[model samples]
Target: MRLLGIVGWTFCAALLAACGGNGDKVNTPGPVTPGQSSASISSNTAVSSLSRSSNNSSLSSGAMVMTCASVEGAVFIDETCPNWQEPSVFEQQKVNSNIYYEVPFGSDGALVSQKIIDSGDALYKKVWDIQYNNNNDFNGLPHFRAAAAFPAGVDMSAYATGKLIFDIKVLASPEANPDFTVHIECGWPCYSTDVRIPIDELNTWKTYELSVADLIRDGLKITNVAMGFQIIPRWGQQTNTHFQIDNIRWVKGSAPVTTKKCFAQHFDRTDWSYTTKVETVDQMPLDSSKWLAGVGPLVTLIPQWNSVGAAWGFSVRDTETLSSCAAKGTLSVSVLLPSAYVDDGQMQLGFYFISRSGLYYILDGIPASRLKADEWNTISTTIPAGKISNAEYMGVYFDSKGSNVANGYILLDNFVITHSLVQ
Candidate 1:
C-alpha cells in the first residue's frame, strides 16, 4: 500500500553513514534500548560497554577500556561492506564528507559527489593536481578538498581518541596570503576548535595533526557530536584562494566490529505521509514531495507467517552483502503491545540466521511480556557464532500464534543487521 501520496520531488543519494539528513530515523526493534546497537562483546572486558545512550536518540562512546578485539558498530562504516561492518580498523578515514555523489568512491566504497553544500562565491575544484609536493608521506592520495570546500556537521566523534590527520597544499592564488581555518566539532553541544593556516605554510604540502581529545579538553564528550566537521576558508574575498586538502581522516587505535544500520521503517513519523510496509530500500513508497530529498530503499518484512513460512526476511543488495560480515551477530527490534494484549500474556520474538547452505540458526525466544504496554520498547540479543559461520542472510521469524490469535500484532522497526567486515 503506497499510502503516502506525492508531496514533493527532490532527492539526494541515500548513503546513511555520511548522510546529511535523509530524515530516516533508524530504530532498534529488539528488546534492548533504542540506539544501543553494537556488536556482541564480552561483558568481562575491561570496558563493559561501548554504546550511544542517545536517550533513545543517539549519543557517543564514553572513555572505554583500551584492550578489545573490535567494537561492533564502530564509528566508521565501511562504505563498501554490505553488512556495514569494517573488516579492519580505519587508521585514517579520508575526509569525503559530502558523499552526495552520482557514484561511490574511495577504498571504503563510500558514495562520492562534488558537493552537498554550496561554497558561496568561493571557487573550488576536486583535484589530484597539487599534491604540491607535500612533505608528509600521504597514506591515501589523489583526492583532496580544494578551494572553499566546507562540509558541514560531519560525524568523526567515533574516532574521538584518534588524531585529526591531514595534509594541505597551496596553489599560490592571486588572493594575497590566502589561508583557511578548519573547524572540527565534538558532542551534541558542538564543542569545536579551528586551526589557522599561515601563508608561509600554504606554499608547500605538509601533514598536520590535531588531538581529538585536546579539542574536547575542557572535559567535553566526543563520543557523540553535535556537529561533526567544517572547514571555512577566509582569504582575499571574491579572490578565490586556491588550496587543497589531502587525506583528511581520523587515525584510530584499533579495529572493532561494526554494524551499519538503516531504517527499514519508523511508523513514528507524525507530520508527513509514510509507506507502512516495505521489504527493501527500493520499495520505500514515500511522499517524494515532503521527501524532496529522495529516500533510500525501504527495509520491510512480512508480518505474515502462515503460507509465507518466513515472518521477516531481507534480500541483500549491492550495497549490502553476506560478505565478510558474520564474526559478531546482532538482532534488535522495537515493539508495542496494548493493554488487552498484555492481558493474554506474552508473545515470542525469534531472531535467526539463514545461511547460504540453507541452514537455520535461531536464537532463544524473546517474550513479548518484556515489551511495554502501548509504548514502544526495544529488545536485543547476541547471535551465537559458529551456527551462523556461513550466514547468507539474517532476520526475525515468529510463529503465527502472535499474528493469528494474539490480541495484537508485533510491531517491528529499526531492523538492525550485523556481519563481520573482516573474515
Candidate 2:
C-alpha cells in the first residue's frame, strides 16, 4: 500500500530487444504552467503549442523549442535563455541507465527525457507520444510508464500555490482494453504520491490539473523529492492504444474536482462537544424557562448556549478534526429574540476548508436582513461546498449590521445541518 514513509522503485528498460523497433530520433519539446515559490526554482510554467509531424516530432529538427521554466504558478519561462537547463546530473539521467543524460521522449524529445532517443515517439513539438500494447510492457510491469527523475536539489514548494499539470489526450478508448487506468506518481519525502484517475475522457486534448496542497495533505513533503516524474498506464491488454502527453508541469491553476454529498450535525447536548460552554441553570423568573413540549407535559430547563450582544460568532466544537464542509450544504438554527428586535441586523453563515487542514467559515449571508423577530425562526441558507472539497463544519455570525441594541439577546436552539457527508 502507498502510505507515509513507504516507497516504490522502478528501473529502466535494460535490453534493446524489449523496445518496439527503434523509430528515427525525433525533435525538441516544449513545456508549460505557473506558480510562486521561495526557493530559486524557475517560476515560468507555460506551454506553447508547437507544430509537430504526425508522430509529434518538431517540424524543424535540432531547432531549440520554448517551454515553461516552471509551472509552480508563474506564467512562462524563457527557454531561449542559455542558462536555463536541468539543475543537476541526477535530474538528467535514466533510472537504470546511469548515462547522466536527459532521456529524449516523444518522437525523440523533452523534461528529464530531454532529447535522448528512448522508448516513446515525439508526437509533436515538446510532447511524448507513446503507442503501447501488452507485448511492449517493460519487464512485465503492470502498465505503460513514461518517467524521469529530478535530482535531489529540486524544490517543489511552489506547488503549494498551484497544481500538477498533465496536457494529454487519448487516441484510443477503453475498447483497447476495459480496465484502463492512468497513474501519476511522484516520490516525495517519507512516501510516494500516486493518484489513480480512470482513463474516461476519451480522445481529446484535455488538461488535467491536480492540487499540490492535496498531495501534501496525503503525506507528501515539498522538501524531499527523490522520485522521477511519471505517467504510466495499467490494464491496457490489447488493441493498440495511442496517446500524446506534453506540458507535464506544476501550474498555478486547478482542474475541476468532483464532490460527494451526505453529512450533517444536530446541536444537542448529547451530540455536541461544547457542553462546558453552556449552562443548565436558568437566570429567568421561576418556571419561565420551562419548556412546553407540544406532546409532553412540561420540561425543566436544559443546558444551552445563548448569545448576547452584536457580532456574536459561534461554531461547532472540533470541526477542525472533521472533513471540510466546504462548497455546499445547509445551516439551520432555532432563533428567538427580544420582542422589540427589528429586522435590521443581518445573519451570515457558510463553510470553508483550505489546504485540507484549516477550517474557515465563509460569508453565506451578511446583507440578509430578513431574520424574523421575537418568535423562534428556523433560519437557514445553502452551504457552498465548492469552497472546500472536504467540508469540516459550519458556523453562523449574527451581525447587528451597525444597529445599536439595548441589552438585546439572540436565543439559539437545536442547530443542525442536512445532507452533510461528514460524520
Candidate 3:
C-alpha cells in the first residue's frame, strides 16, 4: 500500500519550509539537537566507523539567511510549459524576512508562470528575466540587473575561495532534459556565462552552497558575479516554459571548495515521485534490473515532485566489473535536499551508493550542525569506479528518514552519475 494523505503532506511540506528564514528558529517537527549517526566523509572515504563525527555542520543553518527585499506591482502566474494549461496560483506572502513563493498544482505536470515583483522593488525583479521557449524544455534565463551588484564588488576571482549562498525553487523538467546549471558572468557585468552548478531537480525550493574558489577554477571570474536560470528542452525538441522563483540571496565572504572536475556524466530527464511507506522503497531502483535504483518515491512521471511534506531520491549498487584500487572510476550525481527536517527527530534523510569495488557507504545520517531544520539545501558528490570494487554491478540510494508514524518530509530530484577523477 502507498503512504498517502495529509500526514504525508505535512511531513514533506514542513521539511521544505525549514530551508529559509533569517537563520533564527529551527522549523522542523522536532527539538533542536543532533540526530542518529556521526561518521561522514567526502565520498573519498570508506564506511570505516559510524560513530565518528561526520560534517553535520554541512546540514546546519548558520550563515544562510534571506532578508526581506522590497517589491511592488502585479506578480502573475501563467502557463509556459509544453501544454498551455493554467496551473493553480497561490499566495505570495513575504514571510519572516524571506519571500515565500507558493504555487498549488496537482501531481500532473504543469508549468507555473513567473511572478513579477516590480523593478523598483528592492530586488528589481526585471533584472532577472523569465524567458520562455528559449532553447530548452521549460527554459528560464535570469539576467541580473546592474543594480543587483554586491555591496562589495562581485569578483569572479574571489568565488574561488569565497562563499556562494542562495535559495532557489525549481521543479524537475525531465530526465535527459533536466534543469541546467546556475551560471554567473564574472567579468564586468560578469556576462560570460558557464554552468558552474546545475539545479538537479524540479518541484522544490533548494538553497545551494557555492564554493567561490571552485567557481574560479571552473573558468568563472570573481568580478561581477551574477546568478540566473537555464533549462533545456526534452522529447527531441525545445520549448519555453515557466518555473517559480523566490528568496534568492548571496552571502559575502563565504568558504570555498577545492577546484577539480572529477566525473563523466550522462543526460537524464525522468521526473520525481512521492511516498511515506516501506512500499515506497520499491519505486527507486537505479535501472529496471533492480540492481540499480533508477528513480522513485516522490518522483512524478512528468517529473514534478515539489509537493509539501514529501521526500524523493535514487540509488545504485555495483557488481565486480571494475578495478578494486583504480581510485578513479566515474561518479556523477547532482542532488538537492531541503534542510527543513534537520531538527526533526521525526525526520531523517540521506543518499546511499554501493560500488562494484566491494565498497559501499551512505551520504546521510541523523541531523547534525551543517544542515538547519527548515531550509532547502543542495548537495553534490562523486562515486569513483575503484572506490567500490572491480565488481560487475553497483547500486545508488536516496532516502528521507522519519518516524514510521511521520511528522516532517523532504523534496528531492535530479539523480545524475558522471565520470570524474577520484582516488
Candidate achieving the largest lDDT: 1
Angstrom error of the Cα, residue 71, model 2: value is: 5.0
Candidate 2: tens digits of C-alpha lDDT, residues 1-423: 000110111122111101111111111112211111111111111111111001121222212233554333222122111212221212212333343333322322122222212223343344445554433222111111112333342345544435555555567643643233222223311322234433545665555554454343223344443332344444324225566555555554332222222222222122233311211111122221322211101011221223322243333332332344334454444445554344544332212222223323334332223333443334444444444444333334444333454444554443333343335
Which residues of candidate 1, in runs, are more than 4 Å off?
1-152, 156-323, 333-343, 400-411, 417-423
RMSD each, Å: 19.6, 23.9, 17.3
- lDDT for predicted candidate 3 compared with the true structure: 0.29
Instruction: State the C-alpha lDDT per candidate.
Output: 0.33, 0.32, 0.29
lDDT of 2 at 323: 46
Each candidate's number of clashing pairs is: 48, 52, 117
- For candidate 1, lDDT tens digit of each residue in 89-204? 11222344332222213233121112112212122122222212221211221222211223223344456445555445565554566545544433222333234434454445
**Deviation in Å, model 1, residue 306 alpha carbon:** 6.9
Instruction: Please give the lDDT score at residue 113 for candidate 3.
Output: 38
Candidate 3, 162-230: lDDT as tens digits: 344443444334343343444444333222222233445554444455444333322233454433222
Alpha-carbon error at 129 in model 3, in Å? 10
Question: Candidate 2: which stretches are off by over 4 Å?
Answer: 1-66, 70-125, 134-153, 173-193, 235-239, 253-423
Task: Single out the weakest 10-residue window by summed lDDT for candidate 3.
Answer: 18-27
